[model samples]
Target: MAKTAKKIGSSAERLLKVTEALCAEHGLESVSMRDIAKAAGVSPSVIYHHYESRIDLLMAVFRQRFGMLLALRAPLVAELEAQAVPDVDKFLYSIMAPIAFMRSKGEDGAMASRFIARALMSSLPEIKAEVDAGIRGMRETVDIAQRAFPHLSREEICWRLHFTFGVEHMTHWDNERLEIMSDGLCNARSVEESITRAVAFAKAAFLAP
Candidate 1:
């Protein structure tokens, strides 16, 4: 019994480490339980003992990242409600505020942002459901839209959200391309510029008749 329990504990730690490494090297979709087990130096069955399926494991991966983002967004809630700053642009800045901060936090945080951006772009239903559940304000913006722009319908409101999201996802790019494209040329390297462009474009597009 003692030996078996020790083995289980060891397997759990390995699984966690493997999960982190996978996130760092590749996003959630590219990993497999067998790959995780090999990275952890444990047998493949060990992962099954802990997770029912690979999707569950991937959920665990993005769940942690989602949690991190949510926590980062929490503080802005009060400001959001206060309407301290006029217009939806402030709200957009608040929502993306945390993600921009991740830029200076080194590779792990940066990669998390990239991985998350990629996941949202994919066609996987699991990913879509998880994102819907994870990013509450993503859809909550509908309320703001309705209140701010009564001329728009429920369907039009949804379109604005999609447009906003599409602009955000456009930031996900190849680092190689970025370096080549912007080495000496003008490009928005700072997070502030990217956010400004996205927020401005979204507001203009949504507010336009």
Candidate 2:
């Protein structure tokens, strides 16, 4: 039974890796179960055996990538919640730092980041629902934001948080654009700098009236 479980885990991991690469290279909607099977050198039936449908496979990939991110941020987030005075900068950093850490992990990490980027931008109902469900977990962050900015309405805080998602996503996805636009004067590859700038930028945006 242990051996069987190990084999199942390995196969699922292989399928996820192949699916992530294909989805990253050729957007989420463009990839099919057959395409994933071909890339992974498995049969389509095997893919179906592991996942109920294309959306299920995609959600698994989404959960897999974001699960790492949530794990990284969980401790930091808990620390913020424990603080008597919420440090907006630290709160923002807690969110962006994990993404920067992921982006610094080389090609595999980049593929994961790309998959996340595609998932965030996907308009499919299934994808959106998953994303919304994930965002609901941010209630703690929202509570922190409310405490930090008492004057802001919950609606406004939610909107700013949504905007923060855009900034965080772009910082990872189109980071190279900054370097190109800056003519090498700026370094987009520096994870520390990226986190610092993203946190500072988001902090200001959140504080804006």
Candidate 3:
């Protein structure tokens, strides 16, 4: 029974891995179940056995990626909370570091970043809802923000978080835009440097009245 469970789990993971790679290569809207099944070297029926539909598979991929990211950030959040003075800098770093780490991970990370960005801001109602449901990390970040800036209302903290999201999205997704705008002077290719600048910018925005 344990061996059988392990085999099932392995197949499920392969499906997700193939789906992630395809989604990263081709935008989410374009990747089909047949595409994933073919990539995973499995029959479409087999894929269906594991996931009910395309959306289910996509949601599973997003949840797994975000779950990993949230796990990485949770400890940082706790450490910040334990601090005598809530260091907003450290708070921002804790929130942004997981994303930076994801961005540093090559193609799979890029796909996760793009999916997350779209999930947060997508216009498609069904897709947006599923993606939003997978966003525990964002809520956790909000909790930390509220704790860090107790004087600020939730609404205010969320607005500031919006700006921080913009910074992070740009750093991860459209990293080269800065280079184009700055005429090649400000290099945004280095993930560490990009996060440093973004944290600085976002940290100020959060502290702003």
**Most accurate candidate by TM-score:** 2
Candidate number with the higher TM-score (1 or 3): 3
Q: Which ranges in model 3 have alpha carbons more than 4 Å from their true place?
A: 1-5, 121-126, 134-140
Candidates arranged by lDDT, highest first: 2, 3, 1
What is the alpha-carbon lDDT of model 3 when measured against the actual structure? Answer: 0.79
Per-residue lDDT, model 1, residue 195, is: 72
lDDT of 3 by residue, 146-192 (tens): 87899999998888888887777788778778899999998787878
How high is the CA lDDT of each candidate model? 0.68, 0.88, 0.79
* Residue range 23-85, candidate 2, lDDT tens digits: 888888899888998899999998888999999999899999989878888888888889887
lDDT of 1 by residue, 1-209 (tens): 99999987777656665676675567666777788877877677778898788777767767777788777876665566666333676766665567766643687777677666666654567978887675575555566566656788989888777777666656434333555787846355567666787678877887889
For model 1, state the Cα shift of residue 107 in Å: 1.4
The candidate with the higher lDDT, 2 or 3, is 2
TM-score (all chains, Cα) for each model: 0.74, 0.91, 0.83
Error of 3 at 39 (Å): 2.8
Clashing pairs in 2: none
Return the candidate ranking by TM-score, descending. 2, 3, 1
Best by lDDT: 2
Model 1, runs deviating above 4 Å: 1-14, 20-27, 45-50, 84-86, 122-125, 135-137, 172-184
lDDT comparison, 1 vs 2, better candidate: 2
